[model samples]
Target: MVSARSVAVRARSGNVTRRLLTGLAAAALASATALTPSTAHATPPAHSAAVPAHALTGYWQNFNNGATVQKLKDVDDAYDIIAVAFADATGQPGAVTFSLDPAVGYASADDFKADIKAKQAAGKSVVVSVGGEKGTVSVNDEASAKNFADSINKLMDEYGFNGVDIDLENGLNSTYMAQALKAVHAAHSDVVVTMAPQTVDMQSPQNEYFKTALAIKDFLTVVNMQYYNSGSMNGCDGKVYAQGSVDFLTGLACIQLEGGLDPSQVGIGVPASSRAAGGGYVAPSVVNAALDCLTQGSNCGSFKPSKTYPGLRGAMTWSTNWDASNGNEFAGQVGSHVHALP
Candidate 1:
């Protein structure tokens, strides 16, 4: 029993300076063979016509420890308010980024703390985003909440992360969800809890997912509403949020307000890559568009382009690699936007 209080730890190996892996990165890997319902209720969502948020965080999916270290460094160099995601000892299907070597093991929570310290030293705020779409663990009593809390506390003690992100997507809505979030905060007072959920559009509103989220509002930090790739009907509906897609963005804001969550906690999720093959990934939409105009052919894999969504916390990319062509040249474009914000 960790007692849900702060636990300091020592640095272990495989640690970064201050980057916290928040976002639904690992959930993407969990195999979704099923789903179950939870007992909770969320007030219907409502948005404000007056003030739309001015700034929101732009997250990047950096997985595989330092496999994408350079890529992450590139993102760090480019985006100012940067967010990278990591799997809390998870490896399976649809993972945004994960280590394949089962034997590699994770850096001790102390090591993560050190990493967070390093990140803070560099003047960056890092938060650990737990769980992804495979929120399947919550489905079973196999809830890793205890392990999650213990590991997070140890890491917090060592590194002092600004917050912990509770990203339980499609997870089995249960009492466990509240337990895990509250426990983390109880241990760490200043730790922020953010989440990214399925799209809250015309089709998604009917689901009980909103109710599940409303349960832990007190502990919830940011309820990042994704709009990039939101429209497509893929797994998790990757198109749930797309750049220049304000309609969906507004809908998400309305839900946050209706749910009584602070709108400031609402950050919108966007994709840097415009992927193809109906996966709702990030591929070069610009290159694809040029392909559409210059020649007349399928816009699949023909070109590699990056996104430039103006005025928000920042922009997020679907991943670090797709065609092995990123070449660490585009992170600055994304980083500059993040740097520009206060």
Candidate 2:
């Protein structure tokens, strides 16, 4: 979804770049359907908090792009995990700020802090997400990595964020990113860390993004690979699955599952609405189909997983803003399906 601060990617035709689509601009279109699940316990946060029970994850944009403008407290409960998107990086090393959009409703620092706690009180995880389609933040070296860690930790304390999300789209340094995360986790053992890498960034274990995931696998919460924006890609079976198809979702997810990622650490990321992404936008039923196929091994496409992963964490959407605009179809349909999983 195109947030006031996030850049939107557009659909493009090509062999290489097409396979790398993350989140971009696009017109709204008909949605697609479903998927399955697996069960594996993730390391709980250090605090006495509720285990992550819900599966539907959504991003709460700090500003309104086209949809209704709302604050973090205004987000729907359908989202089990809510990530606050696009924390701006200050030119000074690892320093960062919320960079709330001036065009939308505004909230004071205290207002944001209170809302974050309120969301947590209701069992929702609120995390500060760094980077976006056009995010400039990066931990390129050791010093920058330290800066990243210190800055994020400061934000966590100030905003009551329980975790951090690595949505850096432009580039990633596996070593530095891992170091920064490890530093944060060292202080707050319960901190949740999520990543939103493009499809190409996850194809193999060697890719930097994939390496980063592996580097932090022990403490990582979920790696929700963006399956939209991408055009077509090969499934685990070596067959190509086109965008917006159940085969595409299951097939791509299989790559992560079989590529050394634990079932609990991998999640399917899609647009809340066609408008939220340039290309891939499937109906909630289609998403359910993909989830069922992967987790239950029923109603599957041509390519099914060799084994079921009942512990599979869940699904993620581009933004809660679009979900709200689309009548919350994504969270409504996918949320119910994920919660019903074992």
Give per-model TM-scores: 0.53, 0.86
List runs of model 2 lying over 4 Å from the truth. 1-54
Q: Give residue 161's lDDT in candidate 2 (0 to 100).
A: 85
Tens digits of per-residue lDDT, candidate 1, 229-315, equal: 344322222333333433334333444444444434444454443331122233333322322221232232322123221222223
lDDT of 2 by residue, 169-215 (tens): 77888887787776776545567788888888888899999999898
Q: Score each candidate by Cα lDDT.
A: 0.37, 0.73
Instruction: Give the root-mean-square deviation of each candidate in angstroms.
Output: 13.9, 11.3
TM-score of 1: 0.53
Best by TM-score: 2
